[model samples]
Target chain A: MASQPHSLSYVGCNFLRQRLVLSTLSGRPVKIRKIRAKEENPGLRDFEASFIRLIDKVTNGSRIEINQTGTTLYYQPGLLYGGVLEHDCSPHRSIGYYLESLLCLAPFMKHPLRIVLRGVTNDQVDPSVDVLKATALPLLKKFGIDGEGFELKITRRGMPPKGGGEVIFACPVRKVLRPIQSTDPGKIKRIRGTAYSVRVSPQIANRIVDSARSILNKFIPDIYIYTDHMKGTSSGKSPGFGLSLVAETTNGTFLGAELASNPQGQGTAVLPEELGLNCAKLLLEEIYRGGCVDSTNQSLVLLLMTLGQQDVSKVLLGPLSPYTIEFLRHLRSFFQIMFKIETKPSHEELQGGEKVLMTCVGIGFSNLSKTIK
Target chain B: ASESESDRKGIQNAPEKNVDGVEWAESKAVEDEDGGGDVENLLKEEEEYGEENDFSADTAGALKWKEDLTQKAAEAFLRQQQSAPNLRKLVYGTVAEDADEEDDADEELGGLFHVSRPDKESKQKANALDCSKFPVETPQDWDLDEVMNSIRDCFVTGKWEA
Candidate 1:
């Protein structure tokens, strides 16, 4: 691809996905230079290459050029041509890494995106498939992108190192999203979770559920953690166990937290009960960081709000993540939009930490590529 | 001077009292002070120019405008700060420059291989791991009764507003 002088130029390999995503959405070309240029074994890694490949697959006529050492990547973004697609993501990172960008781009596609993603479903790194299914899917529905077609189904659970997971994600395309006003995230009414064990003993799942329930029951009696014991083919190549808990508020807010154990041979063997209790503590920490959306899905909701119809959208979020902060800057560059951010101090006592109120008028970007049927 | 001082106090108390928010307010207030000083110097230069033309120290009406210039700028600064939320500016306003300075320090150290400096805080921050989990910074001791009571209102069983 010939580098256009007007393209937005950035340095380093960090935030490559966001730069590409926003550029694709806004139809602006981007040039990323000095990607791992200073490192001993310089240039883009396999995982990043996989991400770029996935991006190329999902779009139409996107011209991507990387230099001899694969350090510099110049991408001229094409139209979002979404269709039924399947891609095997690199096992270096979890499927969640790829899914995060897809969530941002799926709704604005030409056709509804129905993609089957196969890779590490759960890992210590990145937000797992369960958490995204529990938290991000519901958050998308708030912007009125809901129908029978919208779903994220995990057919197989895979752990890190040797991943063999499979999950199907389908989202309906929308012409224009309704601008949301979600300032109030009401009191959590119930706690729900999935304690999944694959290729491990079935009793381990029970042990996890018992220990997790012991901790969470102190707060709310409406706690129900289901133990999912996948057998045979549904259990992926790697053996692992983990927990994903979601706290549902009275006003339909879902704050989710998940913890996957160490892989089969990564390190010391983890006790299921200990993993369960620690995961419960993580859930408590998430509750303390309570907001309309959880920390993991903060960027997703913000992106949706930015792309919504041209009306004011306000959301109360607890503490912005570093990724979300960078996303905000990228949003400003790509869309020429900035959010009205305010720190909302918690009222009275015991209500967790400081919440950030983000207000922005949506760019009113309609899906021009969507075919009229 | 008194007006500007009081306005500074108001600027301090204008934003919500979080650790980050307070620090941001301080940074902005410092910028405002710098801006105020520059404008005051410009006004002084203008006053000197006027005195060069007409040369009278006792022209009270003319001198008062110069005196009020800083006061007015301070007041305007406070007003604008109060009106628009500065949190957004704090987050995305300025990029950290320490990393750039360090990068320039070793542009061509050995002609072949440039000297690589140790990773500074800003360097690590710029190329930090991209994960969306906002880890608990100051973990609250939930064992204590006082700490437990703080979050009681968050639950249905906790105290509800009337």
Candidate 2:
């Protein structure tokens, strides 16, 4: 247990989740300091603290230490003893914040992870559960992390401010992930979306659908947007409406865009029609970017590629988001893996924007804790 | 105003005037390296040569051929910039591997007073909110006819290339 590799040290609170997740996956120790050190409330925010607690719940024998002021933290990761667990995520940030990290760590766990995450399911910040369910779950399947058990089910709908939503995420464990080579995104065949409303008029969902369809119908006649208006206990605490759109390509690529109304008592009130129109435009922008994986899941794809079975994995992607760029840097520090990134200009006419072709060989890390039948 | 005053002062000083002339000649020689000045020099020599050969057409055609060479080169460079940006270097800086080497040097500053060494950009990024959603920076108006037409080929209903 004491024979771990040299610990990596970093400063600041940004990207704390990735650093810890990578440390757990790579079996490394990490020390982070100066979390909001200069601020009036200098320390890890409640949401980040909640995230660390969630990480603790999933793993076994992990060592975590923080200073009195909580400005510094040292994490020595333990085995990913993933089992049935539940967490009430801090509502300041949406559950997407926690779910994104869980998505990366789930497949490599000893036991298949079945976790119930309760918090804001849809919010202005972070990728909503609906978008991830539609986009990321399928992307994981492409890497062969699929089985009868893989599922992300939203039992309740919650908006921000006073979140009461709950979602159950279950993923099957894999000893080794299959390397993928997905360069061609192919043409989009159809568009599907969900317009959800809670504690608001159910008619709001229909108005969103109609406005979004009006814009999307010009591209393809195959368009379907479901209206989900959860009521009673399933409706959660706040009143809100939003739309999440996903475009599926002929070659199994998914591009997604979503917009949620501002959390109750925050910002200006958003009109459903305006939100729908803007969300449709956002989807168009995503389609124009045109890659094999959605922008939100770019880092997830790269992470899976790095953990594949000692084989080269190549993926074509749109512009690298700033968050994804930092995740790449963190991957290097943890796994000592560097991606060969090449920009591929869209040579074909009417095919979105410029793309980047990423190539990397996996570290061939196999799950040691996985019990053999 | 300052630039004009400096030029006037340089002219008033005799030694400075000579130095300025030398610097101008040096820049002209550097421009010759770019082949701009070289072409004019070659044409001048050719005009003198053509005085004997009586071939005016060759020199005129040479001048016309070199007319927009610099402009064409500039356009080609801009096209390259728009197309193939070095994404690897963009994502991971050139010194990414050795980025921690500076930290070791900075750590030992004066021993007693710990040096806060994080630069402005990294310091700001260090505490920034961590969220994965990439919002659109500049959304294209979907109502515009040309914007709608730009992505027309992305759909199955669009024409398939034979």
TM-score for candidate 1, residues paired by index: 0.82
TM-score of the A chain in candidate 1: the value is: 0.97
Q: Cα lDDT for residue A166, model 1?
A: 95
lDDT of 2 by residue, A169-212 (tens): 99999888899999988788999999999999999999999999
Error of 1 at B16 (Å): 27
- List the global CA lDDT of all models: 0.82, 0.85
Provide the TM-score of chain A alone for each candidate, in the order shown.
0.97, 0.99
Which tens-of-lDDT digit does each residue in A1-373 have in candidate 1?
A: 3664368877677778888889998888998877766668888888899999999999999999999998899999888988999999999999999999999999989989999999999999899999999999989999999999999999988888888999999999999999999988989899999999998899998999999998777788999888888888888899999999999998999998888889877899999999998888888878888889999999889899999999999999988887788889888888889898877767667888778899999999899888898
Q: How many clashes would you count in candidate 1?
A: 2
Worst 10-residue stretch by lDDT in candidate 2 chain B? B54-63
Question: Candidate 1, after superposition: displacement of residue A299 in Å?
Answer: 0.8
Which residue pairs clash within candidate 1?
A350-B150, A350-B151
Listed models, DockQ each: 0.33, 0.42
Model 2 bad stretches (over 4 Å): B1-78, B81-83, B94-120
Summarize candidate 1's per-residue lDDT along B9-105 as a digit string, tens digits: 4454344224434543554566533544544544564455455435323334423344333335445655654554456765677655335655767
